[model samples]
Target chain A: MQPFLPVYAPLSDQQIKHIEDMADQVLAEVGVILQDDPISHEAMAAVGARIESDKVFTKGDDLRALIAQAPRQFTWYGQSPECDVVIGEKPLYAPTYGPPVVETHDENRHQATMADYEALVLLCDRSELLGTTGSLLTIPHDVPEEARPIAMARAHLEHSKKPMCGSIISEQALRDVAHEVGTDPSKCHLMHMINTTPPLVIQPNPLRCLRAAVELGQGNMVASYMMMGATAPVSIMGALAQGLAEIMVGLALTQIYRPGAPVVGGLFATPFEMQQMGPMFGSPQSQLVQIAGAQLVRRLGVPCRGDGMLSSSKLNDAQAGYEGAITLAASQLCQADFILHSIGWSEFGRSYNFDKCLADEALILSSI
Target chain B: MQPFLPVYAPLSDQQIKHIEDMADQVLAEVGVILQDDPISHEAMAAVGARIESDKVFTKGDDLRALIAQAPRQFTWYGQSPECDVVIGEKPLYAPTYGPPVVETHDENRHQATMADYEALVLLCDRSELLGTTGSLLTIPHDVPEEARPIAMARAHLEHSKKPMCGSIISEQALRDVAHEVGTDPSKCHLMHMINTTPPLVIQPNPLRCLRAAVELGQGNMVASYMMMGATAPVSIMGALAQGLAEIMVGLALTQIYRPGAPVVGGLFATPFEMQQMGPMFGSPQSQLVQIAGAQLVRRLGVPCRGDGMLSSSKLNDAQAGYEGAITLAASQLCQADFILHSIGWSEFGRSYNFDKCLADEALILSSI
Candidate 1:
């Protein structure tokens, strides 16, 4: 089935403009803090941005011009030529990322083992619905944390041909993956997750990953993972403006470092439930953020990332289905390009349940 | 909380007009048949509609003019003034209707007894979320099938003061409920489900109920329940147009019988799964029909009916969640009024699962 060409854009032009203006204000005034990343600071300085301590204050117009160097769309190569995927065209689905637990049945959660990870990779490989083989379906506790990224990359190369994301644990992890895959620099062969610390900060590790991945001629997805009411404001538009400012800093860094770098802007915002002091997923408020974020990112002239079936529900029950459907429907309606956590997400990114995955896939197939 | 005022319209004006044109063609040419109802046949003939046996062939414009007599909105009074509900202003939620089985836990289904029916009424009465008490959450096997409607109505009135839908089994059942409730003609005190037989026909029972309900100054919801690909064409727009034509016949009948009758137009279209020979609910295709139907009914100048949390899953699982959410979200997005089956529906309306009801209500509460 063809990707959705939405006739209804939820955000009005004026509303979109207000968000852009707010983001620009944050960029020029609040600025973005980059920790322990000299290359990024130097690049921003070269672009005539003012630097105070670790924060780089820049005109939004200059950042926009630099970000224009990035390609609007790019081809991501798989292990084989036939598996290549074109980003910024259709929603390229990938399975759950960064879950630490696993379950096959209700309330039967356990620490995710290497066996679980391999099983997920095998399951994802066999499904025609998923366009890319995602990293970190779960953190296999058996594997040492540092070596896990390399282990994952090797497994991707050894098992599946679909495009895979590199590890963001450290710059070396990304480099090792590139070497293991024998990545072709002339063409983008890998993608990596680079998250910005919320409320107006970019941590050192993500900064290094962004610069390193772009330099290696690979794609980067700059994700702003904010828990609203804690790291960001409780107001929907307020949190969105903060998220946009942070992502633009990362996107602009890619272009300033290397003209025409492949990058994706992602806004993964969920409300902070005060009662639990944790982030809530698959709420209607979050769905609105996804839809508006898609519209804003599209105007930013790059591919956007959205999550599928993100749920707070523990079981593969009615709660999970409704939450996941609304979230996925938001992405589908807005025509999001890169969809992460497309299925099998449970408990606010806590577990990867196999049964939930099958249920999600069924929903996807029926929709198509 | 305010109901959804959608800024995004899934259908273009041209598309909507195309459906309208198709419906008009069906009304003028193929027409609609009324079975064993001479009053309806005589009423159509009085309006200058050509009566060929039981079928009424009237120009679409004539039907539209007749439908104009019904109010765009109406107030449905509860037993007390404080519990009264205004239907066309917001999505007034009513629980699952017309299921013959009950399940409190997974795989523990049993025939619904009168005690189960009373328990549902008590559960609904205590809830602040449900706007009205709905009839036939499950059929009580202890009651005679012919007397079931009156029993259900008495249970609703004795337990809750909320507005309710009257029985649809027979005309006598409706009159009996009205007499028991001591319905006032000055106010719209009761509503009845008046379903149009699919593929351009209206059964005798529904016609009699519609006439009786309107004459007593009560409300009638004209629902077209079509199993697409079997009863109507398989295409989304085709099924939608056919549904629209059928509903128009029922709506026009209400107005012609009594000007300013309280009425709702409902389009309930689920695909007939060819393999199973059963209707499938909660598919994205059905959601589209719901959304488009909402927009069309708004143009026809009456409140629209939409089902909430309708699902085909036997368990309250992830399939139920996603399906329920997507279906409910469609109604929410379109700001549909008079929502029936707002929670606790399962297996194509076969059972009213109590757990699913709570799960579905949580979703509704969180959204609000």
Candidate 2:
């Protein structure tokens, strides 16, 4: 069956051009801070970037040229050859990542266990909607912190033949995942998520992980999760520009590490609620940003990544469903290429619910 | 704020034209059955239609001309001037209609009472999302059948000031509602639902109600509830064509009864689940039909009506949220002029839940 085409575009050409110009200006003038990574600082300096304290400034044209080196589409292979997936043409669903707690149908919240993690990996394997067994379906508190990534990788290999995301906590964790999976990044079996800290900063650990992944020829989903009105500007355009600038720098570094590496660009920004001092999801502003962010990524000729089926609701109630549906629909209509956190999310990603995962899987498949 | 615009259209102009031609052919050749309604048969015959037994065969152009006489937009008045609603520009939301049972938050379901009916009206009045106190929020089984319309009208007048749908069970009921509301049809104070029984048939009661409403200068929402694969063809285009032909005949009859009477065109079709022997709501095919139906209605320059937040779930669970969100988003993106069943629907509209209604109201308002 043919994949669905996106017929809706929230931004006009003039608006898109304006955003692109603003993003470029931010990259050239107010460069991003590369904190606690002297290796990257020296490498960027060698490539004509100006280093001032932790900030690394580069010309917009130079970054664009580097971005141009990355392939627009790439094959992400699984352990089973039949499970190989394409990145650019159609949207692909991946299970939710990075939640530490589990909420069940009885409304009980408890720390997740390795058993829960394995069960989720098996669920993703069985799902018709989810194409990948995403990393960190939930944090298994029962497992030691250092051993969690290994356990998660082993679960993915045993339960699911689908391609999987690699660990991004540190350089060693990334290598550990690569070694466990036989470390053949040329086959593109492992992809890693590299998130930039908001307000134009890249943390040392994630930056090191990015370098490790690229050096090993693994693909990267380079992203920035900006909390609008807090870490980023309050205006949509301004926040978008800042996010694009930050991600562009990250994408450029990937190209510098490996000139033709596969990378999916992403910008996931939601407004920070002042009263709550936290981020809000599924708001209209966030939805608009998702669409506009896709347009920007498409302009760069690369596949885009976005959150799928997201919600801030604490329960798997009507709010979760409505909010999840809105975000999922937005990602699909906005032409997202890789949708992470596609199922089993609740309480603003604080908890993952088992029943909600099953229900969301049905929703996603029905939509297809 | 400006009402949302449809940035997406499911069908292209060529596809829309093909569907229009198919529908016209069905009207001219296949015709539609006006079962047990001599008034509609005679009125249609007066407009150069050929009546053979119960079927009225009319040329598509004649029906189109009659449909053209109805105004593109009209004011649906409330008791207070401040409550008046414009039907064609901004989208308007109305509560669910025709649920026979009420489900509370505690998961108890019982036959609705007059008190429950009044509470629903008050709820609609208090809701920021619901613009009208839709008719029959629940069936007040406690009230006598003959007096139900009067009771419903009284609830709307005393408990809420929002505009409402008039009774359509019989001509007397329609007139009784008019009298209770002191309705001036010339001002289109009362809007009535005129549903065509599926498989190209118009039931006697609804037909008579349509005639009474048109004669009194009141507005009509002419619609068809086709269950695809049962009452209509399984193909989306085929079902849409059949529904369009059915509604066009009804719209033409309204014009024939009283030329230029207010009428909103509607086509609500869902696929019949053959295995379950029931109709399925919020299917992708149904969503596609809705968007295409909107395009067809826009071609006729009249307002369109559709279900706002429809679901088939038994509870306000994840299924309910996802299904409701899909239909609601489809209706809004399709540029539906007036949305009924905007909240509180469950179990395929067999039951209305109070908590679901409240939650859906919050979802709708937040989206706006």
Candidate 3:
């Protein structure tokens, strides 16, 4: 029931040099592809990157050469030997737990109540997962906005001793959860999915939240979610490269604003539709992009995050299981440092089925 | 890429009635114990179970009722769709790709091979994976006389697929690799794991090999793999049922007798040393049992096989990643039709390493 952290190999001398060299190249020659985000444009300009409108191109050789020198392994600390989980150059790791949101048989996706959150926390507390506990579902949608964060924090405080991660939509919510859970900002591992501002841009609010987590010395997860066929390029490889470029820009800002912030390079890239709103379910391109992109990020010596068991279907049936298993396993096998949507997660992170949760737990036990 | 066959809901109302009746009884009386394997014996037996020893208990209700009731979701026909993938209430169908085998890396420990017979098939062809192809290392030395069967069938066949599963020596291997590939069999969809027999259980005969696979037909894949730790129980349940019981009783016999059969049970239970060896790698428990057990058998309904990544260390690192991820994910998620070691593969399937694989793949995909 305790957290399961894996120990990663220390970066080899070559790998360390690779990270430093890649950083320098990324900073100097390998500029990012920025769109209308004023902050991104300004940041690239300040860094002396060649900027032409929204597209920033750097010296190809410098970027590629530096990237080649990046590290392939890194270490992660845990409360105990048992808590340690390694990233880069190892197998996958399972996330602690996600709360069940939708009751299995429900028609309408209801809000996750305090009781639901509590039960999810209990399940997570009793699971052998990695660093952060997840916001299993849409928590208590009916509760007053002011009381939500506090109610959510109470569950973490009472049920678990593991290093938990979460999202607070507002600055006030962040502080409220912090106080209720008795967490030292320096020790909090904050995680959130930061999607690219579609149609070319990075929004300021997400950037602000990321910066706050960084300043607090909390773990920051910057996810570059790209729908393969929609707002982004149709090519998977292209999408992956673009996503990496965006996140790298974000990561650079983190270091510049708050150096040595515990930032994890995150990518939630998956296939999308130009028409119907549906998940492609185990898009190999998505899986490949995630894996390859994670490798690219780790080349910079930072941990990376990936999605697992994520599907658009809203049920705990075969499609959910198939999609969940493939995506989750890919993330885990690739040795991702941080994993979101690890357990009891279904309907594309919408609702949670108890049976699915049990099934996910059984998988976690069998896998991690 | 070929379309995956799916398991469909039962057609006959009579079958539906039977399944519903079974579900009711199971919910009320045959409550499943999601605990370590040993404790579930009495509960399983209580359902009018026939105990063929601790390792081989078959509750008549568990097998007969469930087998008929089990739907084939995403199952394969003679190169076509065998059934429809039931999204929620129906059983999931997955394919098996590779055979279990170990590869040696610089002579430190025997690691499972990624380019084994079964593994390559999954990757090379349109299989869903590129699994751990074969199952023994230095077999030329370990089983000089027994090498022909593996070489002739499994290795030769599995090399022709796209995605596939891997092999597991310990429970950890299952967990680690599952996390890496983005899914674990036990948790995600229809997957399998093969628990082998103790020191030198198989006699290396052809009939036995055929029988093992044939008997494992749409039944349980809980293979019997005796280990040294807590898996070493006081009775047959302690010894056999702990891990190896599923294969010996549930899978092998089913597969050996019924080719292309579908079964849903398996295990990789092994034992600690009672006589000479001190938990050696690729011990008879790791090799002979799985090879000669139920994995190779052909089931009429569907294939039953268990898989996991095999690693020597307890944490995530290059050794863990290459040893676990490439081997296991290659088979289970990437290819195998029916698989087991889809996740939690590390330290030879003992402990779970959460998110390590997520980060590691960041490095694995530089080539892509």
User: In candidate 3, what are the lDDT values of residues B1-368, reduced to their tens digit?
Assistant: 11211121112344334433543343334332222343234434554454333333344334444344333333321111232222212212232223233322222234233333233233224322223222221122233333333342344333432222322323333333333333322222212334344421322222232233222221223434456564444232233223322232343233324423444443344445556444432222332223222222212133334344454545444234334433333333222334443333345544323243223223223111
Per-residue C-alpha lDDT of model 2 across residues B210-246, encoded as one tens digit per residue: 8888878788999888899999999888998999999
Residue B58, candidate 1: C-alpha displacement in angstroms: 1.9
Model 3 stretches astray by more than 4 angstroms: A1-42, A50-101, A104-109, A166-168, A171-189, A198-200, A273-275, B1-368
Per-residue lDDT of A117 in model 3: 71
List each model's interface RMSD: 2.8, 3.0, 18.3
- Candidate 2, A300-362: lDDT as tens digits: 767898778898888887778878888888787776899999998888998888888988887
- TM-score, candidate 3, is 0.49
DockQ of each: 0.57, 0.46, 0.03
Docking quality of model 1: it rates as medium
lDDT score, candidate 3: 0.44
Over 4 Å off in model 2, which ranges? A1-5, A42-49, A58-62, A103-109, B1-6, B104-108
DockQ-superior candidate, 1 or 2: 1
lDDT (CA) per prediction: 0.85, 0.85, 0.44
How much DockQ does model 2 earn? 0.46
